[model samples]
Target: WYRQAPGGSLQWVSFISTDSSVKKSEPAMEGRALVSRDNSRSESSLSLRALGPRDSARYFCA
Candidate 1:
């Protein structure tokens, strides 16, 4: 999610899953706004996909 602060700067926020998925043991994950900086640095830029039930979770903005 993104919001404009009183000073007019934008802020982003988000979440990420740490555990591996059933599809790939070392899967590539992507997200919006807030990023899970906790994850390890990798060689390539990961593209994020919109989450459906197939992804097992949905991102919500208030």
Candidate 2:
């Protein structure tokens, strides 16, 4: 997943493998975001905690 703020470049947020393993996450999101995958559903999701005004941004997954 990646996040791009208004007028800012895209930044890495988190990476999870097809097999449901978390590979990486940006230091800034270490405690603020949670990335996970559900193998049975073949799905992935990102959860953000304690959101603030500064958290507004575009999120992408590829």
Which candidate ranks first by lDDT, i.e. highest?
2
Model 2, 17-56: lDDT tens digits are 7875546788878888888888788778899998998779
Which residue pairs in candidate 2 collide?
Answer: none
Model 1, position 55, has a per-residue lDDT of 38
Clashes (N, CA, C under 3 Å) per candidate: 2, 0
lDDT of 1 by residue, 1-62 (tens): 23344445543333334532211212234232223322356321223456444333332332
Give the range where candidate 1 is weakest over 10 consecutive residues by summed lDDT: 19-28
TM-score of each: 0.21, 0.80
lDDT assessment of candidate 1: 0.33
* Error in Å for residue 58 of model 1: 22
- Give me the overall lDDT of model 2: 0.85
